[model samples]
Target: MEHPALHQAMLKSTFYPGEAGPVEFHETHISRLYLTHDHVYKLKKPVNFQFLDFTTLEKRHFYCNEELRLNQRLCSDTYLDVLEIRQDGDSFHLGAGSGEIIDYLLRMKRLPEGRMLSNLLTAADPTLPGEMERLGRHLAYWHRTQPPVGGDENADLERTRRNWDENLRQSAPLVENLLTADAQNRMREEVEHFLTEQAPLLRKRQSTGQVIDGHGDLHAEHICLTDPIRIYDCIEFNERFRLADRLADLAFLLMDLDYRGRRDLSAGVLQAYDETWGTDLDAPRLLRFYKSYRAWVRGKVLGFLAQDPEADAATRTDALARGRRYFSLALGYLCRRPSLILTCGLMGTGKSVLAAELATALGAIHLRSDELRKELAGLSPSSRDLSAFGEGLYHREATERTYRALADRAELHLAAGRTVIVDASFAEKGRRDDFRDLARRQQRPLAILWLNCPDELLLERLRQRRGDASDGRPELLAAQKRIFQPPCGESRVLPVDTRDEVAYNVQRIICHLANPEFLKEQP
Candidate 1:
């Protein structure tokens, strides 16, 4: 359609006044789109395929209406309504009129594409870690509210199996023709093994209520980070595609992060989600499975592009190479597993310094109880006053509350498959017991390193300490020592004297954490 004609025709409509202006058209894989000042109008291409059908005008109109309805559930403000394009002589208008309607278009309020999370990340003007955390919490809340798909476990398994099977089957011909024999064989074997080995677990996820109708395409591009982080463009046409293991939805963003070389942000997102959701959820397995599935889906998309007759040789070759890279990345996830180490010690005894160094060495999450306590108390680490301990902050009765909150955060980081160095005084036997309990629950190894310093040295260090979150005044050191209860004989403790060189103390902690058996006889 000509832009001038469309613009002139749309201006006559009363649906959106002042919002309609010049129509800007763009083409994509599936839709012919037009953008106005405040709305986007998307018309489905009249293409017929086994996976999708928009050949007939009526079918196109129905799906257009369906798109508006389903998308409005999540993006109610953005998705305005559906409007049919009616033929008036040679040109078409955007409402019911005299001539036959040949096409349909879904109308929506246009949002600034620059506000997308992907664009924000690329620009790097604003940090999105906090926003991503909030987004994770929101998604968890949404998932909890969704109704579970009550069906037989085998049926759910079969549905997922068919989905994957069809996707792979469609992409196989292109892989065979385009990729080298070795690459094609590797892809086939890896994908087949992944599905075969993880089938039962996938079924278990559904039966255990881990599956839901989620945003099928959850890459950063589809997410807009305004005030509330609007997630739009959910898969509306296919229920089987959208109704999936929630991990699959999460993996899309993680895979995008990996592709963009932002593994740190990926780790942050996974940690936030696991923390908010309160479930172990077999994150490592889910990560691997979903990453591979996402890679395969990307490969399929690339293959489709390669098959397009209009695509030049260079474009096809580039698409095939990109597909191969994604497959290799999926395999990389399978081959590598990072080891974890948990550290424990008293506050202001050089534990934070040691933990920070080790975390840098191992690329781990340096989770400190001090930080968590402050966070739970609604105080920033830089805050000096005990204002965090007001009615909104810490209370005598809220001691356990703070500890549990800390433990919950620690659990999320641990579950996301990261080495966690927990720095805390661990002054009480119950606190140590709680950590031990967490270790047992997580089925991950734990190591406790006690930083021992002479009373004189501790006092000196405390006196020298300038500004820190611990808020341990020099005068309080003596009082803390008086009330301090060291780890009992039953508890695992690797004592390292802080008077020694910092590197030496850190090495000793690392050695003990790496070899718990050697430290078992120490205390």
Candidate 2:
């Protein structure tokens, strides 16, 4: 019988125990889950594809067994058993008997949809970080105990290439309808470049036995926050998909957090995992490659669904939008090259505040010139230097020394692959030119954030300022304004009105940074 006919037959009241009012049917590419009162019956669709095949009853039965066995590793109580769907004369039943077995169903206990990690994270539960910590620790313990997947060095590299090729191939048809042609080309170029450049690291990881049998799909949606914290829905049909580098598995969850706009949570997960695993993992070093790969994979799947002939208009539209978002996210990883941001303004123009906000938002290092100068002078950051404007601790010699020190420290951070924001007055055009030269010499992207405020506002702010790292007073504002040079003719210059709300101005700066034109103009 066809799937529609089988579905109709199975929907009858005789097939289930409770009153058959309504059944929640959720369909994916390979299976249909019929959720009832206390149970969920998953029936695999008769589909044949490059990665999966379930076109026959025997294959369905075998896969049902595989699903049950694989998912039991993480969610033993939820995945119950496989049941034989029997066909009687002009009727269908739920179990094996004298009738012919038409198909198989993986019967499972129904889990609360709201308890899924995705839903809980969306609700912003206070305990999410703690829960994520526990989850990370558990994963660490699991990985340490799991047996290794023995494979030749070439096996995984070949698999990686194949996966990338498949992603590009499958996503080609939807380039015009979903992702733009330029986006597709850029994603391909970035992926190829990353694979070529990181090949040695990848090989070293494999040689050191970093690859293992792991849960192939580790997104938040597949995890539940129940008492025992059940995680389910592992890739069962393909062992090649399940066995991968442990970092790749971790990347799935981290990428999901990024997709959900929870980068802080992503950092928390990495920190907890690193702590529990006793591995000083550099998340920033390798996250972009894996995140881009995972995002492109998601985009490929959504693009496929968008172009699927059987999908309805609403489904196709949703898939297209989602595919575009994932494609954009993939491009973002390419655009996120480390930057040296110069926050320049007069003394009371909120340069420090802008730098702090941007650094926090981008998870970059905030190196304030004022704090570094005080530290160099053997004084606490809060210790006010009451010297004359350009004498004693604030002399030209000390100022030059502070600027030199800031430049050196910024390069150190840049060499370590970090974004650095240097917060300073930068009133001297020579100092500004020096920073511009430094950016060029280091081959890093540079952005100059010039915070401007009206003279009255600046005066008021300076007069009211107390216990600041900067000793700038209202008396210094007039002299600073006469000497301060506004950034001019720089393509990366982003001027902000410091009188505006801090959050609003910060978001405006971030928006500018996210622009494709701006990123493409980066040197």
Candidate 3:
């Protein structure tokens, strides 16, 4: 059944087991969760893929029960039951015994949000390392309880190879369009090299019977740092994903810790897992391989999310931001070389937001033209100048000065071997050309993210914009659109639509940076 309307109608607190209050809603590609004060009601989206299918009501119901069964092993008190969501004409009711059942909900008791492990990472708790150790031991003890999947190393190796091949096959469409095409080649090369060179190690781990029914998706967000840690949300829809070498499972969490820039905590987690699992073997290279594999899986998922048609603009953009970060993060464990980026588009297309997020991900500095223009004019960032498109403070000479200053600052940083992202409306080819020349002279790869959006949404955004440095308005859109250069036939330019069905904007920059040929070499 189509779930969008159902999702909207079920937002009222009447359907939940809580007192009347607002229901918090969240969505992933596979599921939609309704969080009340006491419990979270998770509804599976009807999605059919090669891995699993939840499109039919029977399948969703079975999987909902399967989820309760699998997760009960860890958090028995948390996974309450798989409840029927029945529909009577227009209204929907939770746990209804009558009426036509439309879908099933996995009912789970709410965990403390503040105590979630992801949130606690920033609290600077003195005992966090100890907590990580405790968490690791708990996972290891659980892994031991699970029946081993046996030690047929050849079959297991074949499965691993199959999974990797399927991932590449599924992700081929995203290459070069949403992700860096070169990353696909680089990632495959690395994995194949590991599989060939480390065949003995892979066989040994398999021979030791390390494979088990374990949590397939184990990241910080799924963990709680309570008195006894609670890890929920096991991948129940697919057995292949859930059954793996316990070390592969461990690799998921370790990779997450490393992604969080906490190798110390990763060490702690690994140490405890080793101590509890009765194995002193510490295979760093194997662990690193698994970590990269895990990162690629996550990055590939995010890239799919970047193309999801149902998600909103902000969600899509955020997916792009994370996809780029994750792919680049997995491409090399080392820091990337210096690069340059420019956010060039008309006003009200979300250039600043994308630029800022890109800056945070790439560890680059963001230079906004609007802010810099004001600074150059000796005015505060919020100072208003209601000038026409090409007059007053925004006149030709003034804009040239602002762009020149931006280029100079970017060049200075580039000379110091740092990455730079400049956020601006490059309406003129001459202005963009100046920056291209600067990047060429510096020999740093440069990309221009040209953001676009639906005209109606753009107009509405321009109209509603307030209390910001941007002077974009509905009135100025006609002028901006009429005069804006489209950056046609430019190898360094990537155009993006900002709303739902956006063209995966920021991730393309990562793709460009991953391949040197994507940059313009001409002076």
lDDT of 1 by residue, 1-523 (tens): 2335554564443433455446676776677766777777787877776767777778888888877776776678988777777677767656666877666788887788888888988986456777778777777777777777777776567776787678667767764444333444454565567668877887787789888877788888888878756787877667777777777778888888776666777777888888888867587767776776786678678878777789889988788656655544444454333333444444457877777655643445777766777787687987764433223333445556767876887789878876566777777777777877886676666667777777777677767877787666565566566656776574566677788755444434443443425323321
Q: Provide TM-scores for the models.
A: 0.61, 0.69, 0.63
Task: Measure candidate 3: CA RMSD.
Answer: 9.3
Task: List lDDT for all candidates, in order.
Answer: 0.68, 0.79, 0.79
Instruction: Report the number of the highest-TM-score candidate.
Output: 2
Of models 2 and 3, which has the larger TM-score?
2
The runs of at least 3 residues in candidate 2 whose Cα sits more than 4 Å from the true structure, single-residue gaps closed, are: 17-22, 280-284, 340-444, 447-523
Which 10 residues in a row give candidate 1 its minimum summed lDDT?
514-523
CA lDDT of 454 in candidate 1? 71
RMSD of each: 14.4, 9.7, 9.3
Predicted candidate 2 versus true structure: per-residue lDDT over 1-523, tens digit per residue:
3556779866655577563656778889888888787888899988998999889888888999999998898889999999888777877788757788888899888889888999998899888888888888777777777766677766666677778888888888876666666666766776777678877777776777778888888899899988887989898877777777787788888878877767778888888888988864545657777777787888888888888889999999898767766666665566576788898888889999778756654656889998999999999999987766787788998999999999999999988988889999888778888988888877887888888988899889988998889899888777777877877775678888888756455545654555557666744
* Model 2, C-alpha of 188: deviation from truth (Å): 2.8
Cα lDDT tens digits, model 3, 1-523, are: 7866678877888877554788999987689888888889899999998788999999999999999999998889899988888888777777767789988989888999888988888775678898998998999899889887874776567677778888777777877655566667756765687678777777776777777889999999999888777899989999888777788888899878776767689889999988887864646566666676787788789888889998889988898767766665565432256777888788888898778656654557789999999999999999988988888888989988999899999999999988899999888888888888898899987778888888888888888888889888888889988999888887677777777322234444554565545543543
